[model samples]
Target: MASTTSRHQVQDAQKLYDDRAAHYDDSWHPLFAHHMVQLADLKPGDHVLDLASGTGLVTFAASMAVGQTGSVTGVDISSGMLQQARSRLENHDLENVEFHQHSITDLDTLSVLRGKEFDAIMCASVLVLLQNPGQAIKAWAVYLKAGGKFITDVTHPASQISLITFERVGRGLNRPLPFYRVPFQKPEDLQLLMEQAGLRDNHIVSLSQLEAANAGEGIMAYMTDPAHPRLDKLYTIEDADDVFDKHIDHWAAELLSRPEIKNEARKIFKEEWARLANEEGKIEEMDCVFVGIGTKVG
Candidate 1:
């Protein structure tokens, strides 16, 4: 099976999320909230910013933790997603939370926040989609007051490849996609960028709920997209392996419908996987990723 990872990168993740707005909470809120609360350390009257604040889950979380005296700003590149956030806020009548349709990479926007640096700045699932993360982090540093916390969660790529060992009809198995290990900018890379960007006091934050089974109902919703990866014209047998390799848990679960159906499908997949594990002795398992936190020093 030929690799199709390079081609898969062209997919617009932001647009995909925008289309999944209504289902966003059901699909990703759980998967995302696991490592988010490092920003909750914001003081009672602290100002906080959620970069790439998709669907406002993090902003809402921050707002709740920040108390009535505090304020939270949610910013994202997609206006559609911001609409969902705005709607969610209005529904709750949360005046402390605000939304901005802006690019996280824009330096001018940082200027707009002039002297308005926050006590914390958080950029989550958004970093993986950025074309320039170091610059983006630098912008966050500029937007944060000295000693302000900067936090973000990064999916452990290594854990992903270890989970979904893909097999092509011809190539047999274990030929996972290469991109599973390719981080847009890994934690180490991100740490370097942070230091260069004037963010200091860096540390690996707490590990959130690693397994989905440990996550809450809301977050479970976000990871519960029942749609297949649609490995059609673009994704190859190899690509499918990588697709499974990277998003195996989510996609594999999507293969089922109701609970009864999930159990039935899991029975089949589990048995098949056992054959691969026993006879071929090659099976993949799921893993955990971490959250990183630091302070803007300059």
Candidate 2:
């Protein structure tokens, strides 16, 4: 993460994530399966690293996939997120997961660990938020063993069309939400970044299929966010109300209980996402951005 690219410091991002930690797993969070499916391809003894392992989402999932023989170390700049991650792991009784509070982009110090290289590194939705993702990728490439895979999953630029961005979506609603994008950052740009970082055997995965499976519709459904349907599956019927009450007024939020508006919104979204689907892969496939196993080129 670059000082200039990030308007919010690590502490700030961590703090924001920490606030959502308790409810993080409530909904299906379609992206969860994105990395899980990819990492599952690795052998048990493989070493893995998750950059910006916020609240242990990727780390926790990776721990289960890697098993005991494999080591999973998560590096992030937020202590709050690390603490939450640690707590979640302890609750799961996972002993193989290790987390260090540090900036993952330029990992100059291993005072935190003895290993110098990882078999695979997963960067989940963290690239565009950085100051200079290309440089960061190059710097972090040193930690990869030869043939190691560097995977990055980010909110697709095509996402702008559907409205997955919170700030932008917020404004579209009656209430104005945060409107913004850091600028010059997109999955396409990051793909170029992987090349500059000297990574090879690179394949970009257009992550789709989660809309009907988990969460609700495509990533854009998060745009209107009136009902905040993302949590539809992650929670029991008991705590759903509290989650909505707390979050509905937050930003591009919508309360789905309103009989008329809720039904109408659902209809519109379904029709739109469905329409996007029938067109084939033309106007960007309906899914988040994903990076397949990335090999270190040099």
Candidate 3:
């Protein structure tokens, strides 16, 4: 039983992915490919299912690994994204891969795939976006054959410094930003969810650890970077420069108003701004992703 709010979220997510379909792979592929490839772990002649398979990043990779004898089916809610995926498959002459349009939240919609089991079910970087990730995970596990593997990844909130920084600044200005539509979860929470879903021998892997690092580019550059997959979803303001400038000004003013650490805050602010301005500034933060794997119990 899904909540009304969750239903609305599904609509929103579908729109977002559809809007981003054309450019989704361009930014996301490089960042997420390594983890997806590693977790797919497809052997020759193995069957794989790729849920929310935007642009077939993992789908194509799995197809290659499975070789000619194996098959890969990718399902996504966004028709635009599926269209791109289909084009890729046709262009590559990949006969072993296929695509279907289906919402992850609607398990009933997956009835077309009923009576089918997979050697590996991979849902990369998609669980966090769901309105009911736990429920979805449980549903996905049913498609796994006994002893088959279930794999998914989520962005760890702590490592999302930009969003955290924006929220802090927004709060200081008394204009709190909206919480991310797709909220993150702690590693332990993921483990518990998997266990509840009847997946055994759970394992977790972190792709990158957050650290004090600086990007040599300014906030605008960083936000607009084509390489960062999350940019479009996170930065929705029409004029990036104007919005970022106001945020910095207000944030700086708030910092200066504090008596105890005004001086230190100003220094830190200047350094941060300078770092954003510099294309070579060492941005001291790492994006972290947690990949969880579990085996379906008999």
Candidate 4:
């Protein structure tokens, strides 16, 4: 059973992913998903489960790996994301794949998966979202058969410098922002997590890809909107004018109550963003992903 806090976190995450469903694949997640599938080393006729399977990037790839004999079940809390996955599934010939609207934290309640065991269970880039990731892993391991594979990944703490810097600046201004991502600093951290979850023969590896983005644009987006990663394609700037105004108003009233301090903080924050954006006209960072694979052995 999920605690109240976990339920609320799941709900918030559901909305977050739902809002970003249109633009979720715009980033580097697609390529990472394929890499996660490769790490799984799935075989034909291997029943697989993809947790937090957003947009079916991993689910689709896993379905292909399992061929026609094996089935792949995808579970997500966001219906909007699943809609995209299902839409793509309609046009594809992979009938062995299916998506369900459910939270990974409460997988035990999913009736479709009851009494079922999987040959491999893969959760890609979603551990940071959970408040109690170790517990989730332990629960997920129960669904894996003996000698089955359990694959998941975590981002290096140094990655996503923008969000980290944002939170740091916010704290300096006496306005703490909750980033809600676990700072996994090394591969051993994830390996130990799996081992504590009753998994064995753990293997951990790091992969990095150079990623570049317009820092100024992203900083402005984060400043004006609480939801920094907005679906710009789905909602134009003009269309989101009201949302932007509301967020700004809230920040002024709640985050920075003092007018003088607020003005000074805003100036400082803008300057920091400008400095970051001025770096070669864009921010280039290494997107380091640590992949962890373990075997569910008795």
lDDT by residue (tens digit), candidate 3, 38-139: 655779998988898888888888888899999999998888889998888888988899898888767566766889999999987677566467888888
Residues 127-152 of candidate 1 have per-residue lDDT tens digits of 65554567767777877888789987
| Poorly placed runs, candidate 3 (over 4 Å) | 1-7, 162-185, 209-285
Higher-ranked by lDDT: 2 or 4: 4
The parts of candidate 1 lying over 4 Å away from their true place are: 1-13, 38-40, 107-112, 162-181, 184-187, 206-285
Which scores higher on TM-score, 1 or 3?
A: 3
Q: What total of clashing residue pairs does each candidate reach?
A: 8, 7, 12, 0
Model 2 lDDT at residue 46? 83
lDDT of 4 by residue, 61-139 (tens): 9999999999999999998899999999999988899999998999989999999999999998788767678889999
* Per-prediction TM-score: 0.65, 0.63, 0.68, 0.72
| Of candidates 4 and 1, the better by lDDT | 4
Model 2: per-residue Cα lDDT over 1-298, one tens digit each:
1111223445445655667667765755536544443543666888888888877787777777788988888888877667778887778877788888887755777576555788888877666556566787898788888888888755544454334333332333332222233343344555677877888866555444244444455443322221121222222223323433444444233333244444444444334434333233233323344444468855
* Model with the higher TM-score, candidate 3 or 4: 4
**Worst 10 contiguous positions by lDDT, candidate 2:** 224-233
Clashing pairs in 1: 26-221, 26-222, 27-221, 27-222, 27-223, 28-222, 29-219, 30-219
The C-alpha stretches of model 2 lying farther than 4 A from their native spots are 1-8, 28-40, 113-115, 160-187, 212-287
